[model samples]
Target: MRFTLSSSILLAILLAILAWPVAGCGPTPSAPQAAAIPLESFSGRVLTTGLEAPWELSFGPDDMLWVTEREGRRITRIDPATGEMTEAITIDEVLVDQQHQGLLGMAFDPLLLQGDDRNYVYVAYTYDATPDDGDEQDDPRAKVVRLTYSESAETLGEPVELISGVPAGSDHNGGRLKIGPDELLYYSLGEQGANQFNRYCAPIEAQRLPTLAEVEAEDWSAYKGKILRMELDGSIPADNPELGGVQSHIFSYGHRNPQGLVFGPDGALYAVEHGPNTDDEVNLIEAGGNYGWPHIAGYRDDQAYVYANWSAAPDCEQLTWTGLTDPAGIPKSVPVQTESAWEQDFVEPLKTLFTVHNSYDFEDETCGASYFICRPSVAPSSVDVYPHDGPIPGWGGSLLATTLKNGAVYRFKLSGDARGIRDVDKLFDTVNRYRDLAIGPDDRTFYIATDTSGLTRDTEGGATDQLANPGSILVFTFTGGRVKSASR
Candidate 1:
């Protein structure tokens, strides 16, 4: 044992052991993982441009593209083949704020597509609610209206007010309207951007349920942060869920800015919502279900998120609003609650776009003052479910969610049950804010609506105002080819 071996002999012994493959320690044998479809396999082109703040994109029964212009206060139809635009209607009553107002969602009745006499289109928009007594100026409110379409004249007119006066503000006016499979109108409303930015001192009423008295009086103040189910005539559905011992138009509660609502092939309703700083969510919406908002973000995982009630501060007006935990300006008077503090039963999200630990840095100098966009939240604007027999190979049963911050489309693969997400893939990465998307009949072609102007992350991972396509529709068609595969 005292005798030492030469350096060459010792090196030879070490090499032999390193080359030996130990049982259960070597790489496990498995099928190669399918990589994300390459951008090169897709051909992209601008369909049209020079629009003003396009919001929603839907294909009508006539195979034309219908779009809502938030600033233009107009519903326009586009010929998908020729890109010729036709103004369907101009909402003169629409009150456009600095952002997130004006004409929003539009949906056609099922009978309209069946060539029946019901040529009706439902739309949501914001209008001035200023009191006659001059109580509040520039008070914005939201409503849903039914418009009759004239096939001969190619115009939409005879507007009938359905529901009105849902809480609205300069931001967080979640005005996504959809006609559910049950033949009921489902509308989403936000918390009016309370407890953040300019409205930092405003209290959030998302958890507030409407009383019987308020419902009888048609007061929709409590309708904020809720999804409403109503009949074609704008009356509450007879079979609507009774929440908090009161049966109103509210189908579900506890939502914060749900912008995307779609029905999957499985006949289940899904919603896409924005989180505070992180944890953008994709949820399977259920009747009378409560989605924890201020109490919990993504899950009951006490992670990076904390519901800091700035409005609860005694001197909240004096304290400068800083979107940070324990920032220098924020005092101890501000109340903060963890996700675990909420013990109430609620439905969890199917998936969170991104969730991070508390130790994650928020003050990245690279993003400068606009560091919020650099965070994990992608600012999801809309979502659409791909058919099970989609044209693109291996892309079936996936959700295509458009992001405003990332300027790209994220494809989330759904599990066989369609209740969970299997994996995620990013597609059509560009330097423009994607407002929404409409999948063509071919399913391989997708038309994406871009914001007129906004700040978005650039290719180099920096925030910039320069957009590649502004106020335009960009189309991406998947070409058949063998995509690259990688080991999982």
Candidate 2:
């Protein structure tokens, strides 16, 4: 005999199930120390191979692995269980202006996770500028577009332009997209750092923009050296920091190649922006807060800009330059560079990653005292904080930063309130340009994307290895015991 359920009895059962809490599904962890545990050993394994310059890796609904290829102009979805390619979409409109520019950043519309019937994906890329000008303007501009995905057909529809005409350059088109805790879309901007002002004979003769007013004159159209906050439809949030102008999307300004943005376990937002020569920085992002780039980098001092290098590096002629004694010898061509009289209102970075050599001009400690000498620069690509109770030992309450320069993943062990740093450790160091990393549903799983070309750059020039390594997607498993990572 079967038991029949009444309508009231069925309603009560549904409500009870809805109220039940699920593990690994809750608000962001408030305190990392509560979940901290000693992690003595760890191991990792390569999951899939033959990824062409993979830029980003993230998990969507149902733990489907989504990845973006920088040079391929495509997004591929892979089945984590069998390492099979499930879906792939090629975005042909993306323009490759230089070695670094292409289909660079992508993110899922946060609304999709709410179980909406339809969801869109957002991507940032360089678009051709001055399509009509066959003779002159060949500039590359940055744009963000939204597109709908059809799982049944496994195709991406034509893109709908969300925000376009943002300034972009070959070397410093800061392309990193992230959905923030506020449920808004946030993206970074770079100043196209290789201006080479003195050699270009100012903005008058060679550079078209004669005055700095065009850049800093309260313009939303110009997306140089800024971080923007916007709604899903690409409208500027009204609550964004007000600068007395229509350029309201500006969340923070004065940045140089902000490559990484991550929301911490404690709900804090952090940004990792690259420096020109020496001072790579990791800053605590704040509304209306300016982490000075061209003006003051890392710390409040006049010597910061002195480290900004141009084409022929090892240009130690500054040690014998004529006009350095002047307190205002920093690059003053740009109008915004002189703002607030170099005040300390700009937020200082939590830590300055040493990317340069300390000795300049044959063992000159005085130069290191004032400015960081440029041996090379650390090109940090992406960052993410470990969720509480993660399986990796001592990694639950720490920060993980991935890099392209040295092809290393560095862990920043925190000290106070998630602000101060206790020490940094190498989770795993490999000879691949690590572009992105994502934590899986369980603490025991994680993934990384790498630019696996064997070509190596040394200071100014690079040499290509005879045996080239193709790009790959790696899967890491935490066994919960101290183990040899390389052996595994």
Candidate 3:
């Protein structure tokens, strides 16, 4: 549950290396390397429908799945046994903003089965209205609120402010929350204007500069673009790493917008991050480590923000990521050029290529294709680590993740007993297509939250509905005693 700072940084570096290409090659293989294997998936009946912008899922005290609808402003409960769903509670009394403000994340009190008979679901969401300065999105209180549910897992008690005062932006409110193996609630919050650097994905304005005094004396205590860890009761833990005489509640900083947080079977906290245009990242969160966000995406370091004046040595291979730059400006995009400048300078100015085989202009006419991969129809948004104390029937151990675009939940079985799963794409299978998923105590069934983007799987249908969903929860029942054979 805890790791030293050194291990965290090392893992970050390892993630960077895995994310980018290394040497010059014609193009990387279109498929994952030989060692990588496909993962298996089983389909189940769809449980509930008519959910509006559903976000996260967790198990309640009564063996029902709890879901949050970002736009519906409702907490829903689904019976895992029957796959039937009902709106347990609706927040018609509380102010609801149809925009980014709504229920975003949900977490259950582990003690629900223990001391208190009360069923409680903690949530992070945006409140109605903003500060006069248009900075209300950055206000912490407006970002996260905790509500208690009745014993039947329906209705609500008066809302309690567990921890408030987190900064919100018009968007990029990294409000995903989860209680880690350490029994601490770890959540993410992103900074405003964090999207500008990825020129290809969204319209980006020029970067801003914080005055030197603002940079040093600024109060980072308030959450914004940080991964914060606290007790289930919402108090910052004491053992968190310290920075500058302050016990940084920030387990790690420099994240753009991390939507996924799941502890791997190995007990490591793993995160799935959406990058500007080309990069979508899966990171291992380590205590006291800086994820190098607003400063780095994937393995590429941002030279503009100098950390401690550590001038990254140019010739130093480890300093910057040159192998891959998320094809800036493209969403649901795949890499066109597999060759790195470090290997073939002749292939500079890589031109964009479309799925239809049309080519964007590139100066390098001599270039040849080596890798012809497409962007995944589903962009990974949230992840759930496998082999929990609950029932995860036929499947032995796996990592479950969800995609925003595809509305499919994927379960990845790790190979080798390492802290990381190398070349995961190789293990990808056709059935691995469900959104955020959680295993039931019955083990045979796992619940999934569907994005309901209504996009066709062929033309990248699930891309834009990252937040826009008439979302719903469903249960997947495994018929065979074991997972289906993994496909190639």
TM-score for all predictions?
0.91, 0.74, 0.66
Candidate 3: list runs displaced more than 4 Å: 1-41, 92-100, 115-119, 129-141, 192-222, 300-378, 388-395, 415-418, 422-435, 452-456, 459-470, 481-488
- Local distance difference test scores for all models: 0.82, 0.61, 0.50
Query: How many residue pairs clash (N, CA or C atoms closer than 3 angstroms) in each of the candidate models, in the order given?
Result: 0, 3, 26
Identify the superior model by TM-score, candidate 2 or candidate 3.
2
- Give the best candidate by TM-score: 1
Query: What is the C-alpha lDDT profile of model 3 across 1-488, one tens digit per residue?
Result: 11112444334323322232221121223223222211223343556677776777877767778788777778777776665777867765323442335677777767765667645667887664434565433342344456666654457666777665455555666678887767788887665433232212322211122233432453333455678887766665889776434664567766667777877656677777665433456676777666554344344322111111112233232333322223442222222322121121111101100111112232222222311122322356687765645344423455666755333444454445634443332111112223467767666666777654433122222123233223656555554433223233
lDDT of 1 by residue, 230-256 (tens): 998999888899888899999988888
- Evaluated at residue 396, the lDDT of candidate 2 is 64
Cα error of candidate 3 at position 37, Å: 11
lDDT of 2 by residue, 217-270 (tens): 433445577787888788878798765343466788778788888888666888
Ranking by lDDT: 1, 2, 3
Model 2 vs truth, CA RMSD: 13.6
